[model samples]
Target: MFQQFRYFKPIITISLIMLISGLIISCGSTSSIPIPATPTKEVEVAVVPPPTPTTPAVPTSVPAILAPDDSCVNCHSDEVQLLLTSATEEVEVELSEGEG
Candidate 1:
């Protein structure tokens, strides 16, 4: 009987050690409280209209310029008439008659 008690003493020692550690851990007090989450709400936006584009107007008519022979007559009509009368038959560079 004494032999059996001596053999079980180590098991009793280990059990007591486990029980003491459990008692020490449970002695602390702690409580968890949940926070209320805010909702993500979308805002309504107003639609803006686009601006109209302005058009540029262009003018139509253009003035005409005098030809080379007409400009020569405009500056010196008397010289042109005198040269026309004095020109020979072989002088093939002929002017338009009465054009000036």
Candidate 2:
């Protein structure tokens, strides 16, 4: 019984020391650590009114109508110009131009 008491007493003392240290360590950490502040429910939101719809200004001059004969030129002018520019870069061509 005396031998058992000697072994058990050391184990009990170590366990108690460990438990007390753990509690003390936890308390110290909790005090040092920053807890986030709760957010306020009353937020100041800017209530923006929708933009007032303004009428577009009337045209000062009449717009020109597309010529019926030159429908292809009117529609594909940009594409035609791009193709011509690329083609000219590759090969030199002499042009007898009546109109641009």
lDDT of 1 at 89: 57
CA-lDDT, candidates in order: 0.67, 0.74
Worst 10 residues of 1 by lDDT: 27-36
By TM-score, how accurate is candidate 2? 0.32
Best by TM-score: 2
TM-score of each: 0.29, 0.32
* True lDDT of residue 35, candidate 2: 84
| Candidate 1 pairs with clashing backbones | none
Model 2 scores worst on lDDT over the 10 consecutive residues at 55-64
**Candidate 2: tens digits of C-alpha lDDT, residues 1-100:** 9999998998999999999999889888966778898887897889655555675555555446745565665546788666765543566686777876
